[model samples]
Target: MTTGIVLIILSAALLHATWNTIVKTAGDRTSTLGLVALGHVIPGLVMVTVLPFPSVESWPYLIASTVIHFGYFYMLGQAYKHGDLSVVYPIARGIVPALVSLWAMLFVGEILPAQAWYGIALIAVAIQISSWAALRHGVGRAALFFALGTGFCISGYSLVDGVGVRLSGDTLSYWAWHSVLHIFIVGFIALRRGNAIRALPRRTWMIGILGGIVSMTAYGLVLYAKNFAPLGAVSALRETSVIFAALIGFVFLGEGNWRRRLLAAVLMAGGVALIGLSI
Candidate 1:
């Protein structure tokens, strides 16, 4: 992967983690996600209105991506309801790249060079180390499982959008419409909750709005990157988001048991290094 694309993906990853951290700090998955999702729709709707619509070939992929993204948000809401940012966020986001790598290989007829394979392996090792702490904490296997489900959702969207954007021939329109549907799904859920509109806190709303903007930028960046590169490289670089999540956990959440977290961090760093060096 070119260094510029790698930087874009990693930059998006940081923004992704930043938004997740903001959501966790609020500690209200239902309201936080609901409002954020609803607010996010506005930007996408505006974009789609101004931009040309997606081509016919892209519709299937775009539609599929929308459903997968809904699943991602739903499972993420459930995961947040049950777990902390340190544990759940890593499991949710950390596990995606490996699976995406596998999908790309199995279905796309693409093969990673030996070095990229090692980089992927290192990332897996890092996730395993951090997950050990979760296992020890009696972290609900159910939550972890849900988080993994969320990971699959991530992979699904990545693969679908990877192809979809290329077919759509307009990355901005593709994402704009996809975001519109996705935000609507979440908004519908949020509207059902009584007082959801009235109960939103100004501070939390600000954080969520900021997060929404970050998320839009991240998704847009990835979509644009995929237009000119392999999905695997984009996916691999995106895992760097987990690194930011780990740091966010340590500094913002102050997760207990420093030793295990430190080990996990080292493993994640080593994994990224191995992947980078192999590349």
Candidate 2:
């Protein structure tokens, strides 16, 4: 990958970690996510006016992606509800590269080198290490499963959007439409929460919106990077957000057991570097 692509992906990683931190810290995960979804739609609404429409063939993929993304957001909110950012975020983000690699191989026939596989293993092990202390102290099974579900949802949507955007023939159009589609799903969620929208304070709305914008921009960068890089490599590189999340958790969320979590972060960073270099 070029230096430019590396920079873009790294920048996206930071932004992705930042917004996830916001989500983990929010008082109401579902409502905050709704606000973020609204934020996502604002930019998409603007881009829709300027960009060409996605091809008809891309609509099916777009619809499928939208459903999968909704699952991702819902599961993520549930995960954060039961777990700290350091643990949940690492598990949720760490497993993505392996899952995405498997999906890409089965659906798109993209294969990574052996080194990349080793890197994936390292990342997975790092994620396991992240929870070691919690396990000794009796972590809840619910949080583990929820985080795993979140990871699965991430892999599902990553594969869907990878092919969806490629088929759309316009990255910006595909991205914009994807963001716009998030609105309906979030709306349904808000409705289900019963008057949740009215309960959000001004400050929460601002934070949620900012998080939404950052989330949109972060993945937009990844989609753009995917156009130029291998999907697995790009996904692995982005999972570096796991490490960024660890630091954010320690500093911002006041999470404990940082000694081991920091070690896991170092391993994850090494794995990310190996994956990026393999590309």
> Which candidate should be chosen as best, given TM-score against the real structure?
2
lDDT tens digits by residue: candidate 2, 1-279? 677887898799889989978877888877887888888999999999999999888899999988888788778878877876556766787789889999999999999998888877887777677666654554478888888999999998888888888889999999999999988877787788748767788888899999999999999999999888778778887877766776777777776578888898888777877776776
Residue ranges of candidate 1 with Cα displaced over 4 Å:
130-132, 256-270, 273-279
1-279: candidate 1 lDDT, tens digit per residue: 666766787788888878777776776666777666766687987897799989999999988888887788789878866776557766776677778888888878767777777776666666556546665576687788888888999998999998899899788888888778766676567567637645777887777777877787888899998886667767877777766676667777776456766776676666556555555
Score residue 231 of candidate 2 by CA lDDT. 84
Instruction: Please give the CA lDDT of all the candidate structures.
Output: 0.75, 0.83
List ranges where model 2 is wrong by over 4 Å: 77-87, 138-142
Q: What TM-score should be assigned to candidate 2?
A: 0.91
Q: Which ten residues in a row have the lowest lDDT in candidate 2?
A: 130-139
What's model 2's lDDT at 119?
78
Clashing pairs counted in every model: 1, 0
